[model samples]
Target: MSYKILAVNPGSTSTKIAVYEDEKELFSESIVHSDEELKKYQKVTDEFDMRKETILNSMNKHGVKEKDLSAVVGRGGQLVNIHAGGYLVTQDMKEKLVDASTIEHASNLGALIADAIAAPLGIPSYIYDAVGSDEMKDIAKITGMPEIVRESFCHVLNSKAMARKVAAKAGKSYQEMNFIVAHLGGGISVSAHERGRIVDAIPSDGGPFSPERSGSIPLNYIVDMCYSGKYCKREMTKKITGMGGIKAYLGTSSCLEVEKMIEAGNTQAKEIFEAEAYQIAKGIGELSPVLKGKIDAIILTGGVAHSKMLTDWITDYVSFIAPVVVMPGENELESLAAGALRILKGEEQADPYKK
Candidate 1:
């Protein structure tokens, strides 16, 4: 029996919703929220009602009926670290998402909005492959400093989806192969997927610098700058995440613009762009040992992976380790839908959310 599924993925300024009839998409829409409209909300959770209403209205406009939806799936948000898969949205999960003490991210609203819409219909609402999916071994969490330990925080949803896609194309199950997946976009994360689980990863902040993030920096330099009295804690944080990398050097976050500059004979732009690629290849190489050099493939994905020039450069460096498959774009909506479909078809079980 075919099941109709609704997938909700909330971003910083938009809520992306899609309807899928089994595996085929019926309709999808991105409900963008302007800065002026979003300013009224003190926290990301406060925009819940508005996002949910817009999603429902979009569904109605698209000729989708609420009663026909077999299940609702949402992009999982930041919660206590859990293994990868679909989880039934529970009150325990919702509470953690809205808890002021936890980190505030736009993604935190995904499950909340989905639950609000699905609960009334008496249908299951699930969060799939949450951003905080942490399955790293304890040994992988070690750091040089005893005060710090690495945590798993990468683009789990898209990364896992791409991995599974590659596995299927190779006529093998995900659990039968190992992969090193790099998600390159505004932020970048390189993970070592051993068999089915992510055994280790270089989270966005600790990996190569991306369009906006500074990635890993020298600890000595960071400490010196922190106490330099040049910037406050928040400002420093912004410098590392929001205003660093390509934007810091070239005054723009767009890789396309940098490519344009290269074509226009800007030597600095070319150098910086190459440097980013160099760092990415290095990051991929770092994960090779984790998989013990037995990787089946190295997959490059996410928005920035669309650039042939960038992907080509990275391939040149790391192609020796394994074949580089360039699969661009973050297919997040489809990933959510597929996860829900798997649960609905009894191909996989939906894990319960626990605090």
Candidate 2:
């Protein structure tokens, strides 16, 4: 029997919904909500109700009823360090993804969107590989100082895709290859994948800031910044996650603009962009020993992976370990749907992404 699936990837401002009948898409919509409309709600939790209701309105406008749905799926959120894949959803998962204390990322609202619509209709809602999607080896997990903190990382989606593609070229499965995958978008994530899992990664909260993220700041410095009568937890959230990074340095988020400036002989832009790419290259270098020098590929993925300039930069430096492969563009929608297919086929046991 064919089933109609309603999949969602709700972000901080926009909500994207895709309805599919088996392998064919029936309906798709992207709701680019106004900031004013979004800001009307005082808190991120408040926005949850608004976004869910909006998606409902969208479905209804298209004459799609919740009762007619087959499966429900949404993005995963509230995870700090996680690998990426389709994680099936459950009630226990819900509590883990939502935190009144910690502000929500765009992904946080994924479950809420599904819960608002699917539960009433009695449809099963699944979170396909919300985070924590790859496998890392035992030793990669042990590159630690022992005690106090162990480095754990996720956001393994594109990286895994990259590994699979390169592995096929070498007549190997992803599990049989050792690779370092770097996802360079607004935020940068570098991970080491061995035997099909990402066991080691650099956490944004751990270090290396990105275009919009603050990356890792020293604890003592953060404490001083907090007490200097200049910042609050709220302000810090905006700075670190939103207004900081490349924009903090250059007043814009467009890498296109940054590249333009660099081409026009803007030394500072060249310096920052090169520095960011160099740091990512170095991130791959750091993961080599973890792979025990069995590196087969260095992968570049994410939005910034589309940048020829950036990919070439990383390739030039990281080529010493292995030939670099670039998987261009953000495939979150296809990725989301691909995950649902994996679960439906029983290739993966659904472990819904919760809070």
- Full-model lDDT for every candidate: 0.93, 0.75
What's the CA RMSD for each of the models?
Answer: 0.9, 3.4
Candidate 2 per-residue lDDT over residues 172-202, each given as its tens digit: 8877988888888877888888778776888
Error of 2 at 35 (Å): 1.6
Tens-digit lDDT string for candidate 1 (135-203): 999999999989988889899999999999999999999999999999999999999999899989998
Positional deviation of 294 in candidate 1, in angstroms? 0.2
TM for every model, in the order presented, reads 0.98, 0.84
Q: Model 1 off-target regions past 4 Å? A: none
Q: Model 1, poorest ten-residue lDDT window?
A: 74-83
Deviation in Å, model 2, residue 353 alpha carbon: 7.4
The regions of model 2 sitting more than 4 angstroms off are: 1-3, 21-28, 57-68, 79-86, 99-103, 132-148, 165-172, 217-230, 352-355
